[model samples]
Target chain A: MKHSIHMHSLFEKLNLEDIQVEDNSTLYGQANIERIRKLTLDKVRKDRKEMSFSFKRQLCKVALVACAVLCIGGATVFAAANEGVRETISSLLGISQEKILKVGESIKNKDYKLTVLELACDSYTGIATISVEALSPKAQETFFKDNIVHKLRISPVGYGLREEAPDEYRRYFSFSFKVSKELNLYPEEGLTFSMEGISKKITIPITQTVELTELDIDIPASEGYPMSYQKLYYSDLGFTLLGSLENEDVNSENCLITIEFMDGSISKFYHYYRALEQVKSDNRISVAKTQASIGRSERSVKNDTAPSDEDTIIDFDTEWFSGGSNSINSGKVISIFSFSKEMDWSTVKSIMVNGTTVRLH
Target chain B: MEDYIIIKRLKQNKEKALEYLIERYSSYVVSIAARIGGRLLSIQDVEEIASDVFYAIWKNRGNLIETGSLKPYIAQIARNMTKTRLCHKREEEPLDEDMLVFSSEGVDELIIHKEQLQFLRDTISLLNYPDKDILLSYYFWNYKLTEIAERFDLPLSTIKSKLYRGRSELVKRFEEGGYYYEA
Candidate 1:
């Protein structure tokens, strides 16, 4: 409480009103304004084009899913017809064909037919591919336009769905769920994928469990923030980096994670998803606070232990595909990076964070 | 143009909205950058900062719709961008001994308590108009005494005297409020 106060610090903290001054007409000429306008407008156009391209790519991916669903007509010819789905799942998850559990479980009502095509999981994450075919024409007409998909919920509360494609008769989607105490899908469990009116609890067939590889890391301090790599869990599904930053004001953007593959390819974990923008628009800081409090209460209830003084979960995932907790509270930070395509961990030559590299043989 | 209309057009990615923004706020941004950087920054640097501020507004158009008014947001961006430019310049080239304001006092480090800072803010709010403006311009905005004098159309000696009186009043208030500044 008793400390010497720097004069500059005092000046920096003062929040004063904007100084009212006469117009300095000679400052910026018409040419300067025109130049800035051109540059900014060009950037705006470029961003719009990029966003359009991204949306089209998403639609194409959805089409692929719809095609996979059409190929597998019924549950009777499940193994033979679901080859495309199996291959797609295999490629998306970076797993082998054998690891995918083909559950062509179909249930129908008067309005729709929902089929669970395939599923893949580890101890920390699970992926399920599903198809919802509109049996009624009315349902088909409103399928792509409405919030019908949001009504469909999975038991493990934190599951997120991505629409692969929507055709005249059906829509294909993939659901990714993170493992929690309430829902542990690994080594088999009864998982329920339900809609508002129709629901089903299907037995998640036992499959291979992807072992997590821990990387030996030592990240040196940089930019006044002293950081120490606590743990690194790597798998084809994704990688999670648990570390601590001594400075409480460390921004999540500064904690850069880069993976260098043996094929001279580099993957940087910094891409922000459109959903994240939506989150920010909806006041994400308050949402983050709510999630943090919920996480604390859940941890305490599950283990019958008190919550840590400053434990919080911060989602830093680009796609929000998985529950990647990029938590930073009282200097403890955890960053999770989920891969969209096949990443051969064995092919990873090194992982660098904030200019510090840790080689993996 | 109204802020809402400009924000709507900006969200729609209309180039005219950006043109309007640049036409309206370029001078204001320039004034802020000039005042903050003073003699340390060149005219080119100030111009670049103004351009960057507009570019930032374009990049963050999605979040602008929620901001009821655009001027405050633009002012904040201009201030931050100007400070960042100055910080980078300082790192690249060290300040001269004559330019160091507090280095000669032999008081190396000071930690201002949060409570005291709040009290200082409250006291500063209570100060008279031109005196408060002069103090803020000199200390907070980093405006040179000559620049402050020219901006307010007062002599350099008058600007210096006003700053001295402002500092004395702040110190007296701090002591009366039971907050002591050692050395």
Candidate 2:
């Protein structure tokens, strides 16, 4: 599927207009354009702040947790040790002992597996490092297996920790995991390390800008409109479009169109239309008192056999509301009650809510 | 009769508001569905989704933080609705919130890139003659820092500084124009 899409795009790049013509099949016609526009406009109105308060609160909570943990455990350990040991541990940890102490204080009796690995700091210094490692429930089995040890190499003096720490603050440590399987990893953007227990959730906003090129769909000869292809032409307001196939016997409606010609532009017909002379001047298409089957392309069900007993009537009621002063003055207050009902099943037909009626099937 | 007044009416559960909303945004919804190439849902389906969005907004109008940022807010809602419609069509796949994460990982990158390009095009069209020329020469025309300085008859450092500030200003404009910050 991906390969075909790539090929489709390649063909598109070779000819964009043509490619777009081919692309039109993927999009539904212009029927729901107003709805999409409204929804989009509403979205812009909802979230004014780039980052909401909840997000900030969540970040703060994580920070507080880390601080509490570090203070409870990490501070005591550093305070008990000598200055040299403290310096050594700090170098191995890469972060200031204060930060570690903050994290340790928050952790209360939680079983934590600690790993101490001799590694090189970022400044090429050899350092002893202590870090937390979580062997997820699913990976514990394989991780404990007797796997081949790759190599044991450490930095000379100021190890990988020195890389993150500036030359002035050369005392730091670093540790890394060596996984056997491929892993999808995303480090904190512009930085490698993140605060402990902080969750990173990404939200993407959808955006789009489009220019409507052209509409050239052929309206088929249906019962409603019987206009010949050549006789129907458009002049700015409306027109009829037609299509032909090599096999004239094939169903024209179902035939897939190839909207490509010269200049790398491709055009496809959305639907056939027969514009009435009266409404052509308005450049608008509307259906009034029209009984149109939505999914008509499907196979028809033949009901030659007569039904024995069928009750089509659905019990319904009417709900009404008075229009405003202006609407009442305009003589538009009266709206008919269509359907308000209770049924054994969930289907409701015509529903009159307030003053408007919705046709539901 | 104004759009905002209509929105207020919708919030008040006035039936006329529904008609007004449908009349106003139905075409826009269809256009959005068309752009995304939503094959599972028809234009009518898009209308239903848009209707739901409006209904939700109406129900939660009091809770909305920024009423003025309507366009981007509605854009995000429509986008979410589009995803929901697409996901529901895949009945065999177990419904997982994480599926949205998977869909967003790579596909959104393309969308963001397209938006940025569009924003840049708009910015180019909107900038003044001198600023536009400087931007076009430095960025679009790919003129070297020294070359831009030489062409504009300014110091190389000045040219670079202006370019930097111009880029930053353009970013701020894009942000204001609803190009959301990802991080």
Among these predictions, the greatest lDDT belongs to 1
| Residue A196 lDDT, candidate 1, scale 0-100 | 53
What does candidate 1's lDDT look like per residue over A1-361, in tens digits?
4444444457676543433322232343323655655665666556544533333333333323332332221100000001111124664444666766788887777777877888776544556788888788888777777555555544432222345436567777665544422212222454656565675545554443565666545564454233555566666665655566665443333333445668786655332212223333552221110001001111111211111232332223221123233334445554444444434657867665555556665
Off by over 4 Å in 2: A1-23, A26-361, B64-69, B88-183
Docking class of 2: incorrect
Tens digits of per-residue lDDT for model 2, B1-183: 556666554443333454665566555555554444323345567666776666655556534553443555666666666545533221132212111111122246566555545655555556653455555444433345565566556887776666665555555655675543332
Worst 10 residues of 2 chain A by lDDT: A75-84
